[model samples]
Structures are given as structure tokens and as C-alpha cells.
Target chain A: MTLGQQILQQLINGISLGSVYALIALGYTMVYGIIRLINFAHGEVFMIGAFVGYFIITLFKLPFILALIFAMIFCALLGIFMERLAYKPLRDAPRIAALMTAVGLSIFFQNLMVYLKWIGASPKAFPRVIEITRFEVIENVYLTSDKILTLGVALVLMLALQYVVHKTKMGKAMRAVSQDKDAAQLMGINVDSTISFTFALGSALAAAGGILYAVSYGKIIYNMGTMPGLKAFVSAVLGGIGSIPGAVAGGMLLGITENAVSAAGMSMLRDAVAFAILILILLIKPTGIFGKNTREKV
Target chain B: MKFRSLIKMGVVFAVGFVLHLLIKVGFINGYYDHILTKICMFIIAAVSLNLINGICGQFSIGHAGFMAVGAYTAAIFTKNPDLFIPAAIAGMPRFFIALAIGGSVAAFVGFLVGLPTLRLRGDYLAITTLGFGEIIRVLLLNWKFVGGASGYFGIKPYANFLSVYILAVITVVVLSNFIASSYGRACIAIREDEVAAETMGINTTKYKIIAFVLAAFFAGIAGGIYAHLMQAIMPRDFSFLVSIDILLMVVLGGLGSTSGSIVAAIFLTIVTESLRRFQSLRVIIYSLVLIFIMIFRPQGLLGNQEFSTPMLKEKIRLLFNRTKSGKGHTSTEGTE
Candidate 1:
């Protein structure tokens, strides 16, 4: 393929990968928006979701859509339990304390899975759930069915999230709580439940992202969530941590940049490039692309 | 004050001599000797990290990056004979010089990194430091001169339990002294409240950078010892996880407490070493302990208090009194 065509092809690949990151980034953005705590365990939640989906397909002989749905439900419950058990008690604690708890929970989950022998340290091949077909988009550029499906599912979920956050009463409650917890509580909004719901929603999206990631990569492993989770977090921070649309944009931008670097035959620098962009954005624009700078008050 | 410090130095030397004799007699054994060396290295790293994250309240998670810089710089210096230093100044003296060079370079890099990133606060500062760390690791991975991804090898083994123990003792003494100084109080002030500290005419940024540079210097020394101990070094040796491990030591020891960092480092290192047979269970227990500690006692095991005989006696008395009274009793030891 010519350079332009190759670039186009890489763009297509990047978008598919970017959508997965967008899905995971949504969870991080949403959680940070509400609690102002970086849920480090959110990555492990993604890893568990992949395992759940894999089990649903391989053990129960379920269809791909059913596995995805079940994984979402399971992870939604897990997210709620995780919040109630680990985070709710520390609502009034220092931010650093909560962050440490999240780190602890992340380590706990990763190791727990290994100890239980649910997933060994080695990578497992994800059973093929979708038939992939290539279609020529241009003279030299082509698209795969898997890529199309990934994009389709991600777009639908994002739109659904947008609708929930914008139009639904629960979303309104979430917005109120995030805006001012005391005021919302005084206004009769159930702040605790809203936070739990936010965790559930974010975790559900991460679950879908996990399954899609496993499907794309064709394998699942115990510690698979660390890098992707980190990148998606970088995406969340890049797009402005609290903004939904920003997460989408950041994920896409990160994915594209990473792909472009790889296409230049420097695949090893992919992780480095993501971090470089993060540091630059943090230094130059601490508030990120869509973030509104708020002055600190005593 | 000078006499007291001299006595302290004499005590340190006595301890080092005893340990060295034990190692020589094979009573410590090679395995335990290795573990002791590691404990010393971790104490240095943890104490340095506490200076930045605990005393200064900077929340830096990229400490391992500075450690890497020191390790690679020291390794390169000792491995390449072409660098200027008289061959007559070989052995222990030369190794100490290499460590000093490594530490100085790390401190300079710390100045460079801290100047720009220290302006941000809390989690933003954290992410930025983490970014710098990953960038450093990536750069090292791509640099073929340092052996790239495979790692550099065949450095002289200059580090031993005695040297490392002496350095570790010096690290604690110097840092504790620094913390007791006026500059140390300024760091504590910054940690407590940056705006209030600034209002009090403290140069918050300058103090922050100073703490950061000092912390990096000690971490570099620790890294130099680590490189010499292992006789080989890899980029992956100083990854984000290593930073987290050091952070764990700081937190578990109780932030802002040098004695706490030392105690935590020794305790966790021994625990980890003993549980090396059950890796997954070890990590699980560690996580559980961390979570429970955060939930029940976010101040950490020492809770910003130093380990002392009087404090120990007070704690024991409090425990007995609480049991006798059958009511809750809170100790106000470290509150002041």
C-alpha cells in the first residue's frame, strides 16, 4: 500500500482500538467526575469483565451478545459492592487515603484471581465469537467487520450513556451529587445511591470495553488491564477527566497517535509517546482539552 | 551537640562492625546477607520518598525514575574505564566517588524535573511525575548505549552489607537532621497547608524543590548500591511498580516519620522475603493489610510518630488501661 493508503488503513485500525479506550475512559472519567478519586481498581474491573465474558462463552455456551450482557451485569454488581465495601467508608477521608485504598483494591483483585486459579498467570486464547470479513474501502484501503462491529457497539453505548446522563432522572441525581454533595443531599437526592449508580454505570462500560479488547486481541490474561487501563486513564486525563465527550476525543487522539508511531515502524515507542503527550498536556494545559480551570479556594 | 553527634556516629560504626564480623563468620549467611543489603537499600529509598511525598506533601510517584537515573549513571561510570579518575584511587574510595557522582547527577535531574512539575498539586502532580518516570524508562529502553531492553551487565560488585548499612545509617542521620532544621519545618509547613505556608513568607516552591532534590540524591545513592549489589541493571528494574513499592513503605511507616519509614522498610522487606514461596498469597495478604490499614488507621502504623522506648512504654500502658477500663482511649502522643 502507498503511504497515504497505509495512513488511512492505520487510521481505521486506530479508531477501532480508540473506541475500546473510549469505553474504558468513560468509566474513569465518570468516577473521577463524581468522587474526584482515580479508581485504580477500575482497570482490574475491566480485567475481571473479560474473564467473565470468556467464561460465559466457553462454559455456558452462550452467544457473544449474551456474554457481553452478562459480563456487564456482573461487573455492575461488582462495582457497586466495591464502592460500598471499599470507598463509601472513606468518603470523608483524605483524597490520598482513598487513592491508596483504590490501589490496594486493584492489587487485591489481580492477585485474588490468580490465587483462586480462575485465571492463571498465563494468557488464555479468547474463543472466536464473531466472524471477521474484510471489505475494500478504497483502491488500497480496507476495513474489517470486527472493526465495524467494535465501532458500532462503542458508538451505541456512548450515545446511550449520553442519553442517561442528559435525560434520565438518575443522571440528574448524579450531576447534582457531583456538583455539590451537601446541597444535593439537602435537595433530597440520594447521594450515596447516586455514587453507587455512577460506579455501576462506569464499570458496566469498562466491562464491555474489556470483552471487546479481548475479542480484538484474541487473548485474555490476568494482568492485561494494567497498560490499557493506564492508557485509557491518560485518555481520560487528556480529554479532561470529568468530561464525557472529552474522554471519547482523548481516546481517539491517543489511539491515532499510537498507531501513527507504530506505522512509522517504532512500535516500541507507542507507550512512551502516550506518556509524553500526557506530560506535555499536563504541563501546558493542566485542565486538559475540555476541562474548565477552577481556581483553588481556601 | 557535636559530642552527641560523635557518639551517634560511634554507635553506627559499632553496629556496622558487628554486622560485618557476623557476615565474615558466615553466621549471617549469603541469603540473609542479601536480604540485609536489600533492607538497607529500601530504607534509603523509603526515607528519601518520605521527604518528598511525606514531608513536602508533593505526592510524587516517579521516584524510581530518579533511582534509575542514579543506577544507570553510576553503572556507566564504573563500567567505562575511559572516564577520568586515577586508577590509584580504586577499590572502596573509587566506589564511593562513583556513588557521589551518581547522586549528584540524580539531584540535578531532580531539580530539572521538580522545577516544572512542582507547580501542580495533588493528583495532577502525581500523574505528571508518573509520566516523567515512564518517559525516562522508555528513553532508557531505546538507548542502545545502556544495553537497551536487555539491560547492562558486568559491573564491579562494590556494594556489600557493611557499606550499604553505613550509607543507610548516614541517610537516616542526615535526613533526620535536615528534618529537624529550619528548612525541614518549612517543608512540614508546606505539607500542612501550602497557602498558609506561603502567607507566612515561606518560599514554598523553593522548599519543595529542595526536598525533592535531596530525596533524589539519597535515592540515587540507594540505586548505586543496588546496581553494585546486583552486578547488572535493567530499565525494568526501576519501573512504576518499584515507585509504588517505595510509596508503600512510606505510607505503611506513617508519612513524615523517618523512623517510621525505616521500620516499615525493614518489616515489609522481611515479610516479603519470607513469603517469597507463595507469591500470589503474599500479594493478596499485603493488599488486604493495606486496605484494612487505610480503612481503620489511615495515619499508618506509626501515625507520624517515631519509634522510641518512652512511646512504646506509653502505648503498652494505654493498651492495659483500655483493657481495664473497657472503654476507648485515644493516645495523644504525636498530636503535638
Candidate 2:
């Protein structure tokens, strides 16, 4: 491929990668929006989603779409379970308590998968549910079926999320609670249920991202969530933590920059590049690209 | 004051001599000695981390990064022969110098990192420090002079049970004294309320940096001790997992309690070693315990309370009084 074609190809790949990151970033942004918790275990939820999708396909002989749905639902339930068991009781405690618990839960999920009877400390291959060969768009730039599907599904889920947050009753409740929990409670909104729903929605999106990630990568590991989870978090912060559109923009930006660096023969430094951006963004514009600076009230 | 401190040092030395004699007499075997040294090193790490995360109210997850800086620096100093510091000066004094260099370098790095990031609060500070840790690991992995990802080796084993025990004692004493000082009170004030403390003329940023740098300095010393004891150092030795492990010890011990960190460090090290055979299952159990602790007792077992003899006596008295009062009540009321 010519340089132009190479750039275009990388762009396509970057967008596909970014969309997956966007899906995960949405979960982080949404949860951070409602409750100020970072939810460090959200990454593990994504990992579980991938494992769930893998099992649904391999064990039950389900189609890819059905497996994806099952994975999403399973992860949603897991998210709720996590909030209830590990987070809810600490809702009024020090923030560090919840943060530490999330970190512990993250470790628990990773190790549990590692030592679990069915899943040992090894990477599992994800079976290809839909097979389509790469095709050249203009005699040089090629696109794969997996990339197209990832981008498509990510876009669809994000749109659905937007609708839920803006055009529905539950979404309105979420907005109200996020805006002011006590006031929303006074307005007859169930703050606890809304927060739980926000977790479920975010976890479901993360599950979709996880399934898509496994499908594209063709291999899944127990600790796979650490790096991607971190990068997605960076993306969320980059796009302004509590903003949905900002997450999409940040994810895409991160993907393209990382891919471009790799394309320039710096694959080893790509992770560092992401972290560098995180530090730089934090140092300069901590509110993130799309985040508005809110004055701190005494 | 100087005389009192001298007496304290003499007591510490006497204890160390007795411990060394016990080891020499075969009362403590090599396996147990190793475990004791490890427990000492972990105590240093956990206690120092508690200074920042628990006392200063800053969430610092880059402790292993600081430890790595110290370990690698010490490893390079001892292994490389053509150095500025002469081997003629290379006995106990040399070991101390190497430790100082390791700690100072890590503290310097901590200063640099903290200057930019310490102004941020809570979770943001945590992520930034975590990033710095990963950056340090990556840099160490790629940098060739310190052996990179291949592992640095051939360090002289200057650390022993006696030295580690002494250092551990010094750590606890120095930290306890520091906490009892006014600067430490400033840190506590920052933890209680940064805005209020700032309004009250406390330099929150300065105190935060002081705590972070002091914590890093001790962690670096612990890393030096660790490097000498293991006789080898690797980039993988200092990762996020190490940071999390140290944090777990501090958190489980109860935040803001130095004595609690000491006890928790000893207890958790024993538990971890006992469960070593279980491999991954051990960490799973740890995570469950952590979650349970957060849910049921977020204050931890000690919860800002110290392990003072008077306090323990008082607690026992209180318990006895409660039972005595209950006994005086009707047996049916007690049953109800």
C-alpha cells in the first residue's frame, strides 16, 4: 500500500479500535457521572463479558449475536451484584474505601478466572462467529469484516445509550440523580435504582466492547482487562469524564494516536504514549477536552 | 533529648544483638530468618505507604515505582566495580551510603512527580501516580544500563537479618516520632480537611509533598534492603501488583494508624506465606477479605486506633465491665 493508502488503512483500523474503547469509556463516564466513584472493577466486568460470550458460543452453540446478548445481560447482572455487595454499603463511607474495594474486586475477578476449574491460567482462543475476508476498497486500502462489525455495533450501542440517557424515563431519572441526588430523591426519583441502572447500562456496553474485542483479537486472557481498561479510562478522562459524546471523541482520538504511533514503528511505546497523553491532559486541562470547568464551591 | 535518643538507639542495638545471637545459636532456622527479614521489609513498605495514603490522605499507588528506583539504583551501585565511591570505604559505611543514594534518588524522583501531581485530589492523584509507576517500569524495561527487562544481577548481599531488623526498628521509631511532631499534625490536618487546613494557614501542598517524599525515601530504603537480600533485581519485581499489595497491608491494618500497619504487616505476611502453596487461590481469598472488610468494617480492625498498652488495657476493662453489667441483668434479659 502507498503511504496515503497506508494512512487510510490505519485510520480505518484506528476508528475500529477507538469504537471499542469508546464503548468501554462510556461505561466509565456514565458511572463517574452519576456517582463520583471510578469503579476500577469495571475493566474486569469487561473481561467477564468476553469470557461469558466465549462460553455462550462454544458451550451452547449459540450464534454470535445471541452470544453477545447473553454476555451483555450477564455482565449487567454482575455489575449490579458488584454494586450491591461491594459498593452500596460504602456509599456514605470514605471514597478510599470504595476505591480500594474496587481494586480488590478487580484482583479477585482476575485471579478467580485464573484459578477457576474451567478457566486456568491460560489464554483462550475466541472462535470466529462471522467469517469474511478483507476486501480492498480502492485497490490498496483494505477493510476486514471484524472491523466493520465492531464499528457498527459500537455505534449502534452508543446511539441506544444516548437515547436512554436523553429520551427515556429511566434516563431522566439518571440525569436527575446525577444532577442532585437529594433533590432528585425529593422529586420521587429512586436514586439507588437509578445508580444501579446506570451500572447495568455501563456494564452492558462494556460487555459488548469485550465481545467485539475478543472477536477481533481472537484470544482472551484473564488479565486482559488491565491495559485496555486503563486506556479506556484515559479516553474517558480525555473526553471529559462525565460526558458521553466526549468519551466517543476521546476514544477515537486515543486509538488514532496510538495506531499512528505503532504504524510509525513505535509499537512498544504505544502504551506509554497513551499514559503520556493522560498525564499531559491532566496537567494542562484536567477538565478534559469536552469537560467544562466548574468552579469549586466552598 | 539527645541522651534519651541515644538510649533508644542503644536499646535497639541490644535487641538486634540478641536477635542475631538467637539466629547464630540455631534457635531460628534459615527459613524462619528469611521470613522474618521479609516481614521486616514489608513492614517498612506498608508503614511508609500508610504515611501518605492513610495519614496525608493522598492516594499514592506508585510506591513500587519508588521501590524500583531504589532497588535498581542500589543494584547498579553494588554490581559496577568502577565507581566513584571506593571499595576501601565499602564496608558497613559503604552499605549505608548505597542505601542513602538509593533512597535519595527515589526521593528526588518523588519530589519531581509530586510537584506536578500532588495538587490534585484523591482519585486523580492516584491515577497520575499509577501512570508514573508504569512509566518508570517501562523506562526501566527499555533502558539497557540497569539490565532492562532481562533483570539486574550480581549485587553484593550486604543485607542480613540483623541489618533489616535494625532498619525496621529505625523506620518505626522515626515514623512514630515524625507522626508525633507538628509537621505530621499538618498532614493529619490536610487529611481531615484540605480546604479548612488551607484556610487555617497550613500549607497543604508542602505537607503533602513532605509526606510523599518521606514515604518514598523509606520505601526506597526498603527496596535497597530487598535488592541486597534477594541478590538480584528485576523490573517485574516492582509493578502495580506490588503497590497494591503494600496498599492492602496498609488498608487492612486500618488507615491512619502506624501501629496498626505494623501489626497488619506481620499478620498478613504470615497469612500470605502460609497460603503460598495455594498459589492463585490465596490472592482470591485476599480480595474477598478486602471486600468484606470494606463492606462490614470500612474502618478496618483498628480504624485510626493505635496498639498502645494503655489503650489495650482500657479496652479489656471496658469489655469486662460490659460482661459484668450483663451478668447483673436478668438471665432472661440477657437471653433476649
> Which one is best on DockQ?
2
lDDT by residue (A194-238, candidate 1, tens digit) is 999999999999999999999999999988887788889899989
Give the per-residue lDDT of model 1 (tens digit) for B66-123. 8999999988888876677666677788889889999999999888777766766656
Worst ten-residue run, lDDT, model 1 chain A?
Answer: A274-283
Where does model 2 exceed 4 Å of error?
A: B1-13, B143-150, B322-336
- Leading candidate by TM-score: 2
Which residue runs of candidate 1 sit more than 4 Å off their true CA positions?
B1-6, B84-89, B108-116, B131-150, B309-336
Candidate 1 clash pair list: none
Model 2 chain B, poorest ten-residue lDDT window? B327-336
DockQ of each: 0.53, 0.58
Residue A66 shift from truth in candidate 1, angstroms: 1.2
